[model samples]
Target: PAPPGEGPSLERFTLAEDELRTVRLRVPEGTSGTELAALCDDLALHDWLLTTVVRMLDGLRLGAGAAQDAGTVVRTLRPAVDHLLHLWMPGARVGRELAALWDPLEERPGFTRQWQVLVQRIRDQLTLHAVPAVHREVDPAPGPPAVLPRE
Candidate 1:
């Protein structure tokens, strides 16, 4: 049962800017704990990527102009790297029936692929900030510079 009025099996909310946004996904009735955990795992992945990663990316992008506030970028995103990134564990706990739910998401849109892109962008931003100013280069290599077009 969904402990006292959780709205619905797939309820969701963004509590605040810093905390992880929540998605109260309820497993189908009679689903095993393992099944529920699997469902939770999927929901968690979606929440972290949608809520945290996107927000961090937006912040990093907006703050990209203020490279001086690299510290702020660090302050804003370090916790996510330290705490949130490791939470992804896709089909681990899902029940057999629920396993199919992840398909369309991983198809053309590619949920994990999108997440990977966001993760790399965030890491790149962090790396850019972490480098000392004198050592930082406009374009790291001699070739045409690669860039992640803003989303």
Candidate 2:
């Protein structure tokens, strides 16, 4: 097997859409397979969530023409609400050694912040197209209309 590449990638996450998702990590030399697998799963989840958010954002661009075809914009964003909203757990499973990797990312250009903004935008867009149910006011019955007699 070839030598492991350069620095501690912390972890490397690769997603090929429908084809594959690969998470490669560098742990201490003697770490057990179970530990490695756990790390990979953790990294993969983060990658998938991040990737999903970017994809969701890509569908949201309501400009001048939005007023005409508003429903389509809302429809485009619903999948992110249904599928990607709950997947954010930053470094939840990462060990102390590599937890630092999440810091720079969580700062300045924050992933979680972007995810929140995207979700909110999706919700707001949908709201823009939603029609509220009309409530009609009716007067109280007046003693069954004085017991109408058959003509």
Best by lDDT: 1
TM-score of each: 0.57, 0.56
Per-residue error for 68 in candidate 1, Å, reads 4.7
What's the TM for model 2? 0.56
Per-residue alpha-carbon lDDT of candidate 2 for residues 5-29, written as tens digits (9 for 90 to 100): 4333444445476848764555555
Model 2: how far is 132 from its true place, Å?
Answer: 7.8
Number of the predicted model whose TM-score against the real structure is largest: 1
Each model's lDDT: 0.65, 0.62
Error of 1 at 6 (Å): 30
